[model samples]
Target chain A: MEKVDCIIVGGGLAGLSAAYGLASEGLEVMVVERGDYSGAKNVTGGRLYLSPIRDIYPELWESAPFERPVTRELVTLMGDGASTTIELASDRFATAPHQSYTVLRARLDQWLADQVMEKGGMVITKNRVDEILMEGDKVIGIRAGGDDIGADVTIIAEGVLGLLSSKVGLREQPTARDHALGYKEILELPSSVIQDRWHLNEGEGAAHLFMGEVTKGMMGGGFLYTNKDSISLGIVVGMEAMRERTEKVESHTLLDAFKELPHIRPLVEGGTLVEYSAHAIPEGGIAKVPKLFGDGYLMVGDAAGLALNALLTVRGMDFAIASGFYAARAVADAKNRGDCSAAGLAQYEQSLRSSFVLKDLETAKEIPHIMENPRLFTHYPQAVSGLLEKLYTIGPHPSQKLSSTVIGGVRKDFMNARTLKELLAMRKI
Target chain B: MDIVVSVKTNLDLQMIRIKNREPVLEAIPYKTGDLDKNAVEAALQLRDAVGESKVIVLTVAESNRKVRETIKEVLAMGADEAVLIVDPALESTDQAGVARTLAAALQKIGSYDLVLFGEGSSDDYSGQVGPRVAELLGVPQIGYARQITAGGAGVLVERSMDEYIETLEAPLPAVLTVVSEINEPRIPSLMNIMKAGKKPTEEWSLADLGLDPAAVASSCETLSNLAEEQDRKHIMLEGGAAEQAAGLVNALLKEGIVGR
Candidate 1:
C-alpha cells in the first residue's frame, strides 16, 4: 500500500478545508470523494454562517463563489388557514463583513476543491471509500475500490451516513429518530426578479423559514434562501415523525404541498425548476456525536455528528469546515511532534471542543429533545398566527377593544398549564 | 516503444444546460473528451503490451483558459508525460490550426513508435485532426480503429466501417484514430491521481513551435452556437385505458417503431 501524510475520506467542504489547510503548509494529502465532482451529491438548505469560520481560511472566502450575502432573515409561522412572517434586517448583517451567505453545494464545493488543488492537494472524485483500513485498530488508512492507501492519519468526513465509520464500529449506526431528511429545489428566477421578490439590495440575499402546517407539524420546517439568480426552497421532516404518521407522504410531495401554499405560491411563481435533491441531515446534536479521535484517525463534519439545527439558525456546513480546519491544524501539530498516535492526534477533538463548532452544538444541546415536542412545529405557529389574525380582524359588527381581544387570544392559547410547562422548559434553550 | 496520444479537452456536455434555446456554458467543467479518453486507454494498453514504453499525452489548448487540470486527468490514466501546446494565437483556432500545432509538438517530441487520437472530439465531431496532423507530419494514418495490434516494425488495425470491418497495416510511427469500441478508460487509482500532478509536463507556445502567432491564428469564426430548438409533437388520444393502449400501439406501428 502506498502511504501519504494524510487521507481524507470525503471531498466535501470539510475534507477540502482540511486538505487546503494541510496543503498550504506543504503536507501530502489526498481526499477521496464518491461524487462525480466535489459536491455532485450533496444538498443543503444551504446557507453558510461565515462568522464561525471567518478566520479559518480568511484568504479563501473573498474570491469564493458564494451566491449572495444574506442580509434579511424571515421566519414564517404558518397555520392551516393563516400565516405570519417576521422579517429582520440589520446593518451589521448587511455590512461589508457579512455574517452569512446562501450557497449551492455543487458550486461551493467545486470552487473550494479548486482552491485545495491550488495549494497542492489531490481531490479524487468518483471514488467511494469502501472501508476504513485498520492495522490492529490503529486506523492506518482507507481502502477504496482496489487500493489500500495508508496514511499517518485518516480523516473521516463522509457526511451524515458515516457508513465507513459505522461498518468499522468506530461510530454507532445512525437511527431514524436522530436524523432529518431535507429535500430541496433550486428554482431559477431572473436576478432582478429575485432581488425584487426578496426585497434585496442587488446582491444582498434573504433566508426564510416556515413552520407549522408546512411539515404537518412533523417536527420540521420549510426554508427558502435567495441565491444570485435562483432560490433554494425546501422542506425538512423528522424521520421518526414521518414514519409514525398515518398518512404516509413521500418527501417530494411535501415540498410540492408547501409550495402550493397561498403564502408560498406568490414567492415561487414563474421560477424555473432547475435542480431537485434530497439528503439526510444529522440533527442528533452533541449527545449523538461519536468519538472524535481514536488511534490514527480523526472524524470531522457529519461523520462526527458535528451539526447543529437550532430552529431558526440551522447549521452544518460551518461546523464541517471548522472541524476540518481544526483537524488540519491538529494533524500538522501531530506530525510536528513526531507522533501519529491517538494521544498525539488528541488535539483535533480538543480544538473542536474549544471552537464555535462544538460550543454552539453544546449551547443547543437540548434542541433535539425540545424539537421532539411537536407543538413547536404545529400548535405554536397556529396559535401565534391565529392570535394575530384576531387582533387584526375588522368587520361590520363592532369589534372588541384591542386590549380585550389581545387578552382573550392570549388566555385561550397561552394560559394553559401545558403551555406554562412548555414555556418553563424554554429556559433550557 | 513510445506512444503519444493527442487529447482534446471539451466541456462536460452532461453538465451543460439549455436555457431559452441557448447552451449555458457558465461553470461547466472542462474534461478530457469522451472518446479522447478511449484514445488514452488504447495508448496505455499498447504501452503495456509493447514493454518498456512511454505514453505521452499531447494536447493543444482550444482556448487560453487553464487546461493543466484537464491534461493532468490524462496523466492520471497512466500517461508518463504530458506536452501542452498553448498559445494566445490558438485560442479560437479551427481544426486546421490545431492539427498544425499538434504536428509541430509531435515534431518537437521527435520520438515515438505510434500516435493515437479519438476519431472525433466530443464537442466538435469534426473527425479531421488526426488525418490532418498525419498529413502535416508526413505519416501513414488509420481512422476508426476498433482493434490495434503491435507487430515487429509496424501495427495492424481493424477499422469499423459502415457496412464491414476492414483491416489495415501501417508502418511504425503512424497515426491512429480510435473509436469508443477500442477499450474502456480506467478510472485512475488514488495513487495515480496523487502522482498525476508531479508528472513531467511542458508548455509550448507558438514561438517555441517555430511558427508565427499570426500564421497559426484561428482561421475560422463561430457565428452562433445555439441549441437546436426541438418541438414536441402535441398528440392526444381521446380514449379509455384499453383504447389508449391500442392507439399507442397503432401509432407506434404507423411510425415503423413496433412493426416487424
Candidate 2:
C-alpha cells in the first residue's frame, strides 16, 4: 500500500488550492483529477469575486489568469415586448484593487495547478478515483484506476456531482430539486467590439443579467459576462423547474432563443461561437452543506453544497477557493497534532464558519428558498418593465398626468398584500 | 540492455484556437507526441523482457518549467530515468537541429543496446529526426516497426511498409522507430505518479554537449503559417422533397460529384 500525507481528490479550484497551501507547508500532497487537466471539466458562470478571497493565498491571486475586472453592471427586466435596463457603472468598481474579475475555468484551474506543481505538489490528471478507500467508517484514501493509495487525510473536493462521495454515503445524492442546470456559449468577439457593445474602456468588463421572459417565467435567468476577447453568454434554469414543465424544452433551444431576442441579438451578432458548455450547479444553499469534516475526511467545494445565488451576483468559485484554503490549514493543523480523527479534524467546520465562505452563505441562506417562487422571476420583471414602458409611452390619445400615471401603476402592481408581504419577507435576507 | 526513448512534446493541438486564421498558441498545455508515447511503451516492454534492463526517456525541447512538467508524463509511465536536453536556443531549431542534439545526448548517455523513436512527432510529422539521429549515431536503423522481440544475439522486428510487412533481424545496439500500432501506452498509476518525482532526472544543454548553439539553429525561415480557409457553397433547392431530390441529383451530376 502506498501512502502520502494528504490525498486531495478532484484537481479543481478547491483541490488545487488545498494542494498549493499544503505543499507550501512541506506536506506530501497529491491531487487526482478526472479531466485531462484540472480546468478541463470545470464550468463557471463565470466570474470570481476577488474581495472575498484576496487575503487567503494572496500571492497566487496576484499572477492569476483573470479575464477582466468587471466595472459595469446591467440588469434588464424583460416584459412581453418591452424591457427596462438598469445600468450601474461605479467609479469604485473600476478603480485599482478591483472587487471581482471574470475568469475562464479552463485557464484559471490549469494555471493554479501549475502553481501547485511549482510548490512541489503532485496533481495527477486523466484518472478518476473510482472509490474512496474506507476502513470501518473512516475514509483513509482513494483507489483510482487500479491504484490503491493511502493518506493521512482525504479531502473530497470532487465537485458538484459528488457521485463517489454520495455512493460512499459521505453526502446526499444530488437531486433536480436542489440543483440548477447552466448552459453557456463562449462567443469570440474582438476586444474593441466587446468594449463597444458593452460600452467599456479597454480591458474593462460588464456583467449583464436578464430576468422574467428570459427563463420563460422559470426560477432562473440569463447572464452575460465580458472576457478578454470573448463574451460568455449563458442561461441558468432550475432543474426542478425544467423537469416539471408541462412542455418539454431542450436546454439548447433556450440559449438559441435568448440569442434571438431583439435586445440580445445585436449584442451577439457577428460573434463566432468558440466553446459551448453545460454544467449542473449546486443550488441548495447552506442548509444542504454537508458535514465539513469527519474522521480522516473533509468535503469542500460544491461537494459540500457551498454555492450561493444572490441574484445580483452568482458566487461559488470564491467560496471554493476559500474553503480549500481553510481545509488545507485544518489538515496541516491536524497532521501536526498527530490526530486525524473526526474530533481532531473538527477545526475545519469552525474555521469555515468564521471565514467569509460560511458567513456569506449564511447571510444569503434564504435566497435559494425565496428564489424558488416563480413570481420573482416572472411577475416582478413584467410589472417593473410594464410600468416604466407605460410612463414613457405616448399613445394615440392624450396622456394622463405623470402623478396620476405613477399612482395608477403603483396601485395596480404594488397594492396587493401578497406582493407587499413578499417584499417585506425579502427584507430579512 | 539499456534502452533510450526520445520524445517530443508539442502544444496540445486540439486546444489551439484559430484567430484571424492564425493559431492562438498561448496557454495551451504541452503534450508528448502521440506516436512517441508508443515508442516509450515499446521501450518499457523491451526493458521488462530483457532482465536487468533499464529505460531512459529523452527529449530536446525548450528549457522551461512547462517543458520539465510535460516530461513528467513519460517519467510516470514506468521509465526508470529521463535526460532532458533543453536550451532557450532549441525553440526555433528545425528537425535537423533536433536530430543533432538527440544524437549528442545519446552519446553522452553512453551504453545502450537499443534506442527507440516514433516515426515522426505528432506536431510536425516531418519523419526525419529518427533516421537523422540513426545516421549520426552510425547505427543500423529500422523504421515503422510494428513488432519487436529479443531473440538470440539480436532482435527481430516486423516493419510495415507501403506495400507489405517486412521482418528482419538487427544486431545489438540499433535504432528503431515504432509505429503507433506497436503497443498501447499504459496510463500512469497514482502510485507511479507520486513516485515519479523521485526518479533520477538529468538536464543538459547544447553547452553541456560541447556544441555551438548557432551551428544548430534553424536554417529555413517560415514566411507564414495560416489555417486553411474553406468556403462552403450553400446552395438551397426550394420545392417539395421529390423536387429537391431531383435538384440535388442534377447539381451533383453537373458538378460530376455523383449520379454519373
Model 2 CAPRI quality: high
DockQ by candidate, in order: 0.74, 0.83
**After aligning candidate 1 to the native by TM-score, how far in Å is the CA of A394 from where it should be?**
1.9
Report every candidate's CA lDDT.
0.90, 0.91
Docking class of 1: medium
At residue A70, give the lDDT of candidate 1: 95
Best by DockQ: 2
Cα lDDT of model 2 by residue, B225-249, tens digit: 9999988879999999999999999
